[model samples]
Structures are given as structure tokens and as C-alpha cells.
Target: GAISYVSFGYINKSVQPISINGVQPTENNVKNNKWKIWSYEHIYTRGKPTGLTKKFLTYLKNDHIQTTLFNKLGYISV
Candidate 1:
């Protein structure tokens, strides 16, 4: 076997999200179930976090960060 090429994936305004059958992948389309190419994010651990991870997850879920940082970084809150 030999290496030929490499590939990477992107989300949101950073790069043009690929369209499915001429339907652009947008938040509205995803919400209405028109867009199907999407992935879910999850935090995993052997057990519950007891330190920085816990604090950071709390901050991530906070209203201020969810509205400001998440949107600014082109992430949709779920």
C-alpha cells in the first residue's frame, strides 16, 4: 500500500460546509431535518470529572459562554 492524499474536515464559516443535493448545510436546515450530514459532540471519561474538566464543562454550559463564545466560534449550542 502507498499513501496518496490526505483529508480534513471543517465546520461553519471557517470553511464552506458541503451541500447535500444543492441544499446548503445551515442551522435552519439541520433543525428542520433537511440536512443530514452532521455529528454530535460528547464528553467522555471513565468516571465523573473532579477538577478542571468539571469546571470547564460548567463554563461551557453557562449562558454567557453559550451565547457569546459558542456563537463567536461558530458552534451551535445543543
Candidate 2:
């Protein structure tokens, strides 16, 4: 097959500090987009890699990278 069409995805994410990972996002306040916290490159043709939204979060889950986030701030399933 050819190169195929590229895609763009985004998700809102709350960037916080991780005492374990030693990765503190640039902002103390949380943010949102359409992509997950990790494996952002897989979700977009081109877009921001941090502070994503729920839509992209679900997308990342489909790819099985949901729990693979390097700095998981944890999720609440309400």
C-alpha cells in the first residue's frame, strides 16, 4: 500500500509533578488537549505532545499505550 493518509489527534491532559519520575511539566496548572500523556507521537500527524484531552486519551488506550505514560498522574473513572 501507499504511504496512506496521515491523522491528527489531541486530548486534554493535566500536567503535574511526579515525585517518582522526576518529570515536572512546565506548568503547575493542568491543561487539556485531545491526546494522551504518553505516546503522543502515535496520536498525531503533527501536534503538541503534552497536556492532552480525553478524546486522545481514549485513542491512546486503543493503541494499548494508556498505562505506558512515563508520568502517570493517575486517572479517575467516574
Candidate 3:
């Protein structure tokens, strides 16, 4: 058997059949198995964000945009 690390959304969209067997990196699963997860960070300089940075951050934080990212792009929001 082979194991592939992919997001839940991706699995749903895959043409080939995949089995989760109730295993996923949700909050509970990650807590129980810390080593099975990784994370991404957004780093910015001190002081209030300005210009394109502000706009980009705002766009990324929008509920609709976040929902699209999760649903269409297979991204797990933090």
C-alpha cells in the first residue's frame, strides 16, 4: 500500500479512488499525532501594514476568499 499526503479537498476531487480510513490532520488528529502535521506562516515587518501588503492581506483574510481557497484550492485554513 502507498500513502499520499494530500488535503481533504484534494482527495474529494481526485479521479482515482482514495481511502482515508478516518485519518486526517484535523485539530484532534494533529493533537494526538503531532508529528503528522506541518504549518505555514505569514511574516511581515513591524508596524501597521501599508499599500499592496494591506490589500493582499485583506483579500486573503476575506471569508469568501478563504472559503474558495479551502473548497477549490485544497488549502486548510489556520
| Number of the predicted model whose lDDT against the real structure is largest | 1
Question: Candidate order by TM-score, highest to lowest?
Answer: 1, 3, 2
Residues 1-78, candidate 1: write the lDDT tens digits: 332211122342444445669887776786688977666567886688878888988888999997787777656666
- Worst 10-residue lDDT window for candidate 2 reads 2-11
Backbone collision count in every prediction? 0, 15, 0
- Tens digits of per-residue lDDT for model 2, 11-45: 13432233324533332222332222332234353
Query: What is the TM-score of each predicted model, taking all chains together?
Result: 0.68, 0.17, 0.49
Which candidate model has the greater lDDT, 2 or 3?
3
Cα deviation at 2, candidate 2, in Å, is 59
What clash pairs does model 1 have?
Answer: none
Candidate RMSDs in order? 5.5, 15.7, 4.8
Lowest summed lDDT over 10 consecutive residues: which window, candidate 1?
1-10
Per-residue lDDT of 75 in model 1:
63
Off by over 4 Å in 1: 1-14
Reference-based lDDT, each prediction: 0.66, 0.36, 0.60
Model 3 steric clash pairs: none
For candidate 2, the clash count comes to: 15
